[model samples]
Target: MANDKTSMQLVANGILKENPIFRLALSMCPAVGISTTVMNGFMLGIAVLFVQVCSSVTISMVKNLIHPRIRIPTYTLTIATWVTVIDMVLAAYLPEAYAKMGIFVKLIVAFAIITMRLEMFACKEPVGASFWDGLGMGLGFMIGMMTIGLVRELLGSGAILGYDVLGFKPLLFFILPCAGFFVVGLMMAFFNYIEVFYKRKKGFTS
Candidate 1:
C-alpha cells in the first residue's frame, strides 16, 4: 500500500499540486504563444511531452556519470538533442503543425520545466520514479496547453477543433496573445480554489 501510494503521488504531483503551467507557472511561453488554438497547443504539448519523458529517463540512467559541475550544460544538451529530433520529425511529417509551431518547438530546449526536472527529480531518483515524474509533468503540461487552447479557439474562432459551435465568435480578444495570460490567470484561480477545498476537506489548515 505504501509503495502504491508513493507511486500515485509521484504521478499526481504534476497533474495538480505542481502543475507546470497553472500551478508552478514554469513554462508560459508555449502556453501563451502557441496556445491560440487547440491544434497548436496539442502539437507543442506533444513535443514537450516527448522531450520531457525522454530526457528524464535518459538523465536518470546516466546521472551518476555526469559531473555535478557540468550537469546544467549536460541537461541542456540532452534536452536539445531530443528537441532536435522532434523538430526534424515535425518538419518532415507534420509540416502544417511544424509551420504553426515555428521556433516554439525548438525553444523547448530552454524550457525551465524540462531542465528543472532533469536536475531536481531525475538526477536523484531511481529510473522508475523518474519515469513517473516525467510522465506526470508531461501530462500536466499537455492538459494545461490543451485547456488553454480549447478556450482560446472556442472564444476566438467560435469553433472547437475547427467545428463551429457558436454562430459567431464569442470574443475576439481571447485569440490575442495577451488573452493567454488572462485565461491562464482565471484558470489558475480556479485551480487554486479546488486545491484549497481538497486540502480543507482532508482536514489540513494552512
Candidate 2:
C-alpha cells in the first residue's frame, strides 16, 4: 500500500475527485449510448464494476511478472478475461437485460477508465491498494451510469424502472442520442458546481 493514501482516501478519490464519467470524462460513448433506461444503466454498470475489480486485482498481483514492452496487451488480455466472464454471467442469468445491453458489456474491455487505471495505478500499487482503487472506480462508474439512466428514463419515458409514475413524458427528446450529451453536459456542470461549493466550504480555494 502507498503511504500517501489510506484505503478510504483511495475509495473517496474515485467516487468524487476522479469520477470516471462526470469528473474524468472517461467512457462518454457508452454513457450516452445505452443510458436510455434505468435498468440498462444499472446492468451495464454492474458488468463494468465486476470487470474493473477483477482486472485491477489480477493485474496488480501479476504486475511484476509482466514485461514493460507488452504490458498493454497483457492488460487488455487480463481485462478481456474478466469481461468475458461477466458477459457470460449476464447473458446466462439476465438474458433480458443482457439483450438490452447488447454489445456495451462486451465493449467494456475497451473502456478507458479500466485501462487507464490498470496502467497508471494497478501496475504500480500493491494488490490491496489496487483492489480498493478498483472498487472505488467501479462504484463511481456505476453511480454515474445509474444517475444518467435515471434522469434519461424519467424524463424520456415518464417512468421509473419502466413503471409509469408521471403518466406523461415531459421531455421526449431526452430519449434521443442528442439528449444524452445534453443530460451529461448538464450533470457535469452540476457536479462542477458542487465541487466548487465543497472546496469553498472547506476553505481549500478562494
Candidate 3:
C-alpha cells in the first residue's frame, strides 16, 4: 500500500508540481508554436507522450550498459529513433493530422524535457520508477498543451475543437505567436498562485 502511494505521488508530481510547461518551463518552443488550435496542441502532446515513455523505458533498461563518456549521444540517438518511427507511422496512417502537425512531431526529439528525464530520472532510477516518472511527465506536458490550446482556441477564434462557440473571435491575437507568450505567462502565474494557496492552506492546517 505504501508503494502504491509513492507511485501515485510520483505521477502527481509531474502533473502538478513539475509540469513541463507550467512549472518547469521546458520545451517552450512547441508549446508556443503548435498551440494555435486545440487539435494542434493535443496532437503534439500525444506524440510527446509516446516518445517520452518509450525513450525513458528504453534508457532505463540499458542504463547499466551505457558508457558514461558517450551516454548523451546514445540517449539522443535513442530518442531520435523513436521520434522517427512515430513520425513515419503518423505520416503513413494519419496523414491529415500528420500534415497539420508537420515538423512539430519530429521536433520532439529535441525537446529539453524529454532529454532531461532521460538523463536526470530514467538513468538513475529503477525501471518501474522511471516508467511512472515518464508517464507523469508526458501526461503533464499533454495537459499543459491542451490547456493552452483550449484557451487560445476559445478566445482567439471563439471556438472549441473547431466548433464555433461565440459566433465570432473575441481576441484574434490569442492565435498569434506573440500572444502565445502572453497566454503562457498568464497560465504560469495562475498555476503558481494555486500552488502558493495550497501550500499556505496546508501549512495553516498543520
Candidate 4:
C-alpha cells in the first residue's frame, strides 16, 4: 500500500508539480518548435514518453554496473539507442507522421528533461520508482505540449487539429515562435496561480 502511494505521488509530481516544460522550464526547445499543431505536439510527446520510460528502466537495471565517472555518457548512449530505434520504426511504418517529426524525434536524445531525470532520480532509485517517475514526467510533457499546440492551433489558424473552427485566423502570431514563448509563459503563470490558490485554500504557506 505504501509503495502504491509513493508511486502515485511520483506520477503526480511529474504531471502537475514538476512538469518539464511548464513547471520546471526544461526542454523548451521542442515545446516551442513542434507545438504548432496539436498533432505535432502529441506525436513528439509520444516519442518522449517511450524514450523516457525505456531509458529509465534500462538505466535502473544497470545502475550498479555503470561507473560513476561515465554515467552521463552511458545515459546518453542508452537514450540515443532508443531514439534511433523509434525513429527508424516510424520511418519504416508510419511514414506520414514520421516525415513531419523525423528531425524532432532525433532531438529527444539530447533533451535536458530526460537526462536530468536519469541522473537525478532513475539512477538513484529502484526500478519501480524510476519507471513511475519517467511515466509521470513523460505524461506531463505530453499534456503540456498538447495544451500549447491546441491553443496555438486554435487561435492562430482558427482551427484545431486542422479542423476549421472560427472560419478565420484570430491571431496569426500564435503560430509563430514568438507566440510560443507567450503561450508557454501564460500557461505557466496560469498553473502557478492554481497552485497558489490551492495552497492558500488548504491553509498552507509557501
Candidate 5:
C-alpha cells in the first residue's frame, strides 16, 4: 500500500536523509562531547542508539494513554527509564569507557533528538515503522559521531581506533573541545560536497 511505502520512506529518510547530527543537526552536544577516541565514540553511539530506540518504542506504545496537556512529561519519563538502564549496564561492564564518557552518559536523558523523534514521528506511527525510524536515526548519529572520532584520532592523535596508522607526532590541539567543532564542521561540509556531486552526476535533486 502507498501508506506503507510512505512509512518506510520516512524511516529511511530519518536514518540517511535527515540524520540527527549530520542532516537534522540535532544532538551535536553528545556527538562532540564523548567522541574523544574510537572506543569512546563507539560506546557513546551504542548508548545513544539504545536510548533513542527504546524511548521511541515506549513513547509510541503509550502515546494514546497520556493526555496531550502532559505528553511532554510522559515522554521525559519514558526516555529517563531507558537512559538509566543504558547507564547502569555500561557502568557495570564497560567501566573504562564509562569513565571516559563521564557526564555525557547522564546527559543522554536530555538529548532533544530522541525526544523530538518520539513526539513528532513515533507517537503518530505504527510500532514497526517507529522502530525502523529509530534504528535509522540512531545509526545516522552513530555514523556521524564515529566519523568525527576517526578524524580527530587520526589527525589529532595519528591513529584510528587507537592503532597507529603512521609513526608521526599528532596535533594535540585537535583532541581538544574546540577542535571538535572545527572537525565536525569540516566533515559535514565534506559530506555536503560529496552529496552535491553525487546528485549532479545522477541528475537528481536531493
Candidate 6:
C-alpha cells in the first residue's frame, strides 16, 4: 500500500525541512553556477527534476534486482542515461539556453542531489514513495534556484526573466558567481526563519 504521509512528508521535507540547495546544500554546483538568469535557473531546475524523477523511478523499480555491493554503480548508470537524453534534447531545441547554461547541463551527471536521493530514499523505498520524494525534492530545488536567480536578475540586470521590472541601474557584481552564493544564502536564511515562525505559530516543537 502507498504510504499516505509519504507524499506530504516529502513535500514538507524538501520545501521546508530539507531543501536540496538551501537546507541540505547538496547540489551547489548547478545551483550556484547557472542561476544568473531566471530562464537559465528554471531550465536547470527542470533538467535536474527530469534526472531526479527518472533515476528515482528506475532505481526503485529495480531495487531488488541489483546486488547491494553494486547498487551505486547501477544507479549511476541509470542516472547518466537520463542526463544524456536531457542534454541532447536541450542542445537540439534550446541551443541558446544550453549555451548560457554552459557545462552545468553536463554537470547534472555529477549533481550529488540525484545520487544522494537514490542512495538515501529510492533504494530503500517503494516506487510511489520514491517518486513523490523525487518530485518534492526537485520542486524545492527549483524554488531555491529561482529565488536566487530572481534576486540576481532584479539587481544585476534590472529585470525578471528578461523582462524589465525595476528601473534601477544594474549592479554588475550581482551577476558574478560569488553573488550566487550570497543570494542563495540569504534566501535560505529567509526560508529557515519562515519555517521556524510557522512551527512556533502552530505550537510545534522543533
The C-alpha RMSD of each candidate to the native structure, in angstroms, is 2.6, 1.9, 2.8, 2.4, 2.4, 2.4
Index of the highest-TM-score prediction: 2
lDDT of 2 by residue, 1-206 (tens): 46479899999999888999988899987799999988888888888888989999999999899999999999999999999999889899989989988788889989999999999999999999999999899989988998999999999989999899999999999999778989999988997798799999999965
Q: Model 6: what TM-score? A: 0.89
Comparing 1 and 3 by lDDT, which wins?
A: 3
- Scored against the true structure, residue 29 in model 4 reaches a CA lDDT of 92
For model 5, the stretches where C-alpha displacement exceeds 4 angstroms are: 1-3, 6-11, 199-206
Candidate 2 Cα RMSD (Å): 1.9
1-206: candidate 5 lDDT, tens digit per residue? 11364557766787678888888898989777767677777789899889988888787787788899998888888889998999999999989888889999889889889889988888887777788788878877788788778888888889888888967747888889877888888888999999899999999977
> What residue pairs clash in candidate 5, if any at all?
none
Candidate 3 colliding pairs: none
lDDT tens per residue, model 1, 47-150: 99999999999999998899999999999999999999999999999998899888999899999999998888899888888888998999899988999999
What's model 4's overall lDDT? 0.91
TM-score against truth, every candidate? 0.90, 0.92, 0.91, 0.90, 0.90, 0.89
Shift in Å, residue 99, candidate 4: 2.0
Ten contiguous residues minimizing lDDT sum, candidate 4: 1-10
In Å, residue 124's CA in model 2 sits off its true spot by 1.0
Q: For residues 1-206, what per-residue lDDT tens digits would candidate 6 score against the true structure?
A: 35567578887787767888878889887777778888887999999988999999999999989999998889889988999999999999999988989888888898888899999989888998888899989888988888778888889889988887887747968888888777777777897899899999999999
TM-score of 4: 0.90
**Count of residue pairs whose backbone atoms collide, per candidate:** 0, 0, 0, 0, 0, 0
**Candidate 6 — which residues are off by over 4 angstroms?**
1-6, 192-206
Residue range 1-206, candidate 4, lDDT tens digits? 12444889999999988888887899999887879999998989999999999999999999999999999999999999999998888788888988887588999998999999999988888899999999999999999999999999998999988889999999999998778888888887898899899999999999
The candidate, 2 or 5, that scores higher on TM-score is 2
| Candidate 4 backbone overlaps, count | 0
